[model samples]
Target: MIYCGLILFIAASIVHLAFCALKRNKAADATKVFLMPLLALTSALALAPRLPESRTAFVCTLCALGFGCIGDVLLLSVSEKRFMAGALSFFAGHIFWIVQYVFSPNGTSAYAWGGRMFFFIALICFICYGIVLASTYVLLGKPKGVMGGGVIAYGGILCALNFTAINAVVSGINGKAALFYLAGSILFFISDGVLSYTVFKKDIPYSRFIIMLTYITAQALLAAGCVLPYG
Candidate 1:
């Protein structure tokens, strides 16, 4: 079932990207709507056998992916209101991902030595994220209102998600899963950065294709991280 869902997801993603490249908005959006749900379905099926034991993680994973699906649909609109709503949905999704990591049996239990190393690495990464966030906010013309606050808040949560993902890796609770989580989080961050720059700064070549490509891949990796067995 998981493999079936994954194959469908890849097919949808390819179709969506092709439509995006061809500048077919309607076709692209039609395909885009299924991307997250397919990934969520894949994760759900993967976690099914582990049920009872993985109840919390399963719930969190589904909720996160559910919110991603909502965001995907909401973002299809051209209105600012819808865009903000979509951002909020995605923000909620990030929170759920963070919560999943916090509660997972194989999450966030760093060894003393690894904890210290992670602390330093996290500090540097957070600093870098901060700079990028600030710069992007400025590039967006320093939006002065709810949108401004929302952007800052969203960026902060994204940083937290990335931070938590890195901790998962250094904790050594589940090496393969943690690495997938870390990579997914990083790609997600990059996707958002590219998206914001394209929308608020200036048009980038093949921006839509680039955004959806990274976004869907990130979601797939994150789903994989959640469903893969812990070591």
Candidate 2:
């Protein structure tokens, strides 16, 4: 079932990417919605791998991915309200991830190397970085108040997600799996940066295409990360 779900997700992802590449905006928008449910299903299958199940992880991941789907759909529109809505959706998703990591052994479980402090410190640093980046975006990017707030909030949430993912690795939760999540996180941050710059700052040539590519890759990695066997 896990392999089947993974295969189905991969196939759907390919077709979704094709729509984006072909610039079939409507088709792309329609197809993108299916990705998260497929991803959530893929992640669900991973929960049964071990004896005592980690139901929390499964549930939170599904919640986050579902919100991601909503965000994706909302983001297809260019309106400020829709953009804010999308940002809120992603913010909620990140919150779910933070909660999932915080209480789990992957986060709360201490390592012999004493890496708990690293995650504590990393979380703070990530938030600070978000503030700095948001400040820069506001100063140079020139987004409006609502959009700017959404950007700033979303930036913080994204960083929070990344920090939790890193902590998952440091705490020996799922080495390779965590790496996949971390990679997806980094790409998500980069993709949003490009999106803000392109939307508010000067638009670079083919910037839209670049954003699409990064966004698609980020989502795929995140989906796969959810189900990667712990190493």
Report the number of the highest-TM-score candidate.
Answer: 1
For residues 30-55, what per-residue lDDT tens digits would candidate 2 score against the true structure? 88788888878877777756525576
Candidate 2, residue 176: the lDDT equals 78
Clashing pairs in 2: none
**Model 1 per-residue lDDT tens digits across residues 70-142:** 9999999858899899999999998988888777776564345355787798789888988978987998889
TM-score of each: 0.93, 0.82
Which runs of model 2 end up more than 4 angstroms from their true locations?
48-52, 108-140, 229-231
lDDT of 2: 0.73
Best by lDDT: 1
lDDT of each: 0.84, 0.73
| Candidate 1 accuracy as TM-score | 0.93
